[model samples]
Target: MQVAQATEVRKNWSSFFDQVVHDKPQAVRRNRDTALFLSKTHMEEILSQYRFTLEYEIEEDGYYSGGLKEIDICWSEPSLEELKQTIAKDLVEYAKTYMDNFALYHNAPNRRDHFPYVMHVLMKDNIQEVVELIDADWERT
Candidate 1:
């Protein structure tokens, strides 16, 4: 494994991808304390393990958001199953975290009496996958 920063990764993305295809994973680091990378096989395993279906909403700015609704419980990929399971578990955990934060902000003593509208908006949309990608730190971790 090798470590690189976000800028370095951007500059050498082609070489990095080539290495990934060759089965060598490169770790991306930021602030000298983070790490991120994944082997090609590991990525395939994650895709197979989850077997999730997604629905998305597109905004006027051409951006999009989506989430997993129904998962294929019987999907079986021996090598990558564990990775997929971990991702799914993390999704639920993160959703709960959002809920917790909403609670905190909603109940803040200095805040207005209005209910937490942001939490409602988040809950109304399915964004588990987005959360995973955001939290995963795609480049430098």
Candidate 2:
């Protein structure tokens, strides 16, 4: 959880490598404003701990709705809390925005379709569940 400027990281690449070997991840900041991270083993370990599936369905318009279906049961690691928080925040915002937009367009429709309110509500509900799951830290194991 150490923070270093991007320039500092570039200047001390060897030290950063040593830190990674020692299981210490470093956050590199650019222009003292934006931050990036460097942690090879940590990333690999996280990836190894998760499983992913792709789910797709054909829509009425002959297009496909595809999503990454991630199945992971382990979230006990401290680093995962940040990920959970991010997911929760994103879901909450998404749900709110979708509802706002749906309200605006509930009466409008294209020639081929009816009201899209139901679909938007379903999406909002799904996002709400994601937010709740993240907040509860409800992993399978």
Prediction-by-prediction clash tally: 0, 0
Quote the lDDT for 96 in model 1. 57
Candidate 1 structure quality by residue, lDDT tens digits, 7-109: 8878988888777667666677767776657664655554443334434444345333333344212222232333344445554554455467766745766
Candidate 2 vs. true structure, TM-score: 0.32
TM-score of each: 0.29, 0.32
Error of 1 at 127 (Å): 20
Whole-model lDDT, candidate 2? 0.45
**Candidate 2's residue-wise lDDT over 37-94, tens digit each?**
5465565454342322333444455433333233222222223434454444544554
- Total clashes in model 2, counting residue pairs 3 or more apart in sequence or in different chains: 0
Give the Å shift of residue 81 in candidate 1: 20
Per-residue error (Å), model 2, residue 32 = 4.4
C-alpha positional error of residue 59 in candidate 1 after TM-score superposition, expressed in Å: 48
Give the TM-score comparing model 1 with the true structure, all chains together. 0.29
